[model samples]
Target: MTQTATRDDDVAAGPRASAERQGDVRLSLQGVDAFYGQIQALRGVSLEVRQGEIVTLLGSNGAGKSTTLKTISGLVRARQGDVCLEGESIARLPAHQIARRGVVHVPEGRRVLRGLTVKENLELGAFTLKDNALRRQRLEEVYALFPILHERRHQDGSLLSGGQQQMLAMGRALMHGPNVMLLDEPSMGLAPKLVTEIMRIIKRLNEAGTTILLVEQNARLALRLAHYAYVIENGEIRMQGDAAAMREDASVVKAYLGLGD
Candidate 1:
């Protein structure tokens, strides 16, 4: 099926199809479908992240979790359905255009510039801005949030530890001044201690008023930090609800989260 067709299916299947709407939503994905060649990667995945809330998308590998983030960021164009930022459709916008609209995507693998200094990488993030003072101001803010990057400002991003590189990636995204941050596997490739540290950062960012749409394989941590969440499987959303409720759901606990009954 095409992107639009898939999105339509998602709208029909979504749990909230008949629920009474409430609160201000920041990002809304209605019936979004994505494909890689002939194989469908995402099938009608509908979800929402409300203003000032941390919403987690939890699933196993190949469950279309990353595809969902890419579609929302305009890195992968949806074949069907709409991706709305505050109720305005952005599906057709280019990736850079979408970024300009305050939707910053920190992709999986923490794609930091290995050759550039931490400060230089951050400067590149503000390329869309013309005002030097504003860019410098934002850079200071990111440095403040991640003091290690400031301490190693002159060091190349490649020289930082994995945890520090992840922090740098997040700081680079923040330099863009996004209203909604789409984080894909922010806890990937980290030790248990580092994972906890990253999760704490996610929570802290949300608490400080940044709306986040987090995709994670660490379902336990994701749900713990999220206000609302969706569990996606085989390119479709299998379950969704308040994060606490999902944590209590037997299927969610046993399957995606690897928790005992």
Candidate 2:
């Protein structure tokens, strides 16, 4: 059987889709089908992110990477299947509600509000919060995570460098105290150094207790950082395995990891 039809028996597949594994699944997408005006973007995609794991979804552009994150965050409706968070169904919930429930989607583009100051943009992230004190506390936490944000807190978000803007985007998402973060193409358009920096920050975030579902086109980076990975093609899952194993596969090397001759 294909790995998608069942778990990878050779290596531990973490807790996301494993019924026999311990602890709770932070996010579960089962047979999830998403459509854009009748154009089916996802073909029964199923995956799992266990509590405190970094799972990556790897695919080329237009391969339903962003759509999958959008579906989980409720920006797009699922035409079929179920999305459960800690065992509760959220497939049909609205985007805002999904975010409030601790599922935050940091979209591909660094969509920071250009007109807003760094602090203002981060404040917008806590829109679900009513307590000013708690919001302030969360904002401080985000600033600590991305210290450059604190350095530019008074400047307009657009005035920051690309890497700083990306930091602001992540800081904004952090304000929501997200249990699970759906990050799309975080390494896009960044310098090689900046990409390494951002990936390091992502690893730190997961180490600090946030489950991550990463959508990335950088096959080498994704395979290096992900504990487990799912490869999708034309809206369907094509392969899956332990991230390290996938990295070593001959087909994966030729097709995705840029090691092909």
Candidate 3:
């Protein structure tokens, strides 16, 4: 059975109804398989991320969480099945082409341009735009979202703290005005306080109507912020459900999330 698209009305109702609506998926993978040379990284993985929601990919290291994002973004092509964006197939599209269709990926590491000034780094995000006016407008919007970036506009990205770098990474992605933001480990390598701050920024972004697909090691934090989540194991989805329920699952609590039993 195909999954359903989740609407704003469904979320306020409850989790079960939300899951049912999500079962009618928006961005869907139907038996997707991917490989790197002879080693298979993904094995018939199927999942969904509805529009206007934060869906998290939760799992241990090497569980193909990163690979899933790459495949969806067209950085890695699928060997089998299909990847659809709003019911249109993008499996054959290149990474840049997919990104042009409003799928922006922040990647695993905070890959900010180390030597570039914050303003320069953000300018790079508008490289595909032909309209100078539009680029400037978007840049101003990004600065508004992240005032820190504007404060350090002339400072080199390398000089910023880890939290600040993550913000810059996200700010760069926002320059394109994406419909879906694929964030890989946004909380990685930050102090606890900074992590909370970053997650709050993500929440605020979602509240302002940006859809997010977050891949994070901090399960507790991710689940709390996400609408739905998938638990990946050995390159496949082992469990999928509402985020809050997954957070309470005993196995998930003990194994991947490091929560008490």
Clashes in model 1: which pairs?
A: 3-79, 3-80, 4-79, 4-80, 7-31
Give the alpha carbon lDDT tens digit for every residue of 128-179 in model 1: 8899999989989888888899999999998899899999989988889889
TM-score of each: 0.89, 0.89, 0.89
**In candidate 3, what are the lDDT values of residues 1-261, reduced to their tens digit?**
111122222222112325464433557788999999999999999988887688889887888999999999998999999999889999999999999998999998888887899999998887899999999999998888899999999999878998999999999999988888999998788877677677778888887878889998777667777888888888888888888777667787677544553
Which candidate wins on lDDT?
3
What local distance difference test score does each model get? Answer: 0.81, 0.81, 0.82
Q: Write down the RMSD of all candidates, one decimal each.
A: 8.0, 6.1, 6.2
Please estimate how well model 2 matches the true structure, expressed as its whole-model Cα lDDT: 0.81
Off by over 4 Å in 3: 1-17, 22-25, 255-258
Question: In model 1, which runs have C-alpha deviations exceeding 4 angstroms?
Answer: 1-22
Candidate 2 residue pairs that clash? none
TM-score of 2: 0.89
* Clash count, one per candidate: 5, 0, 7
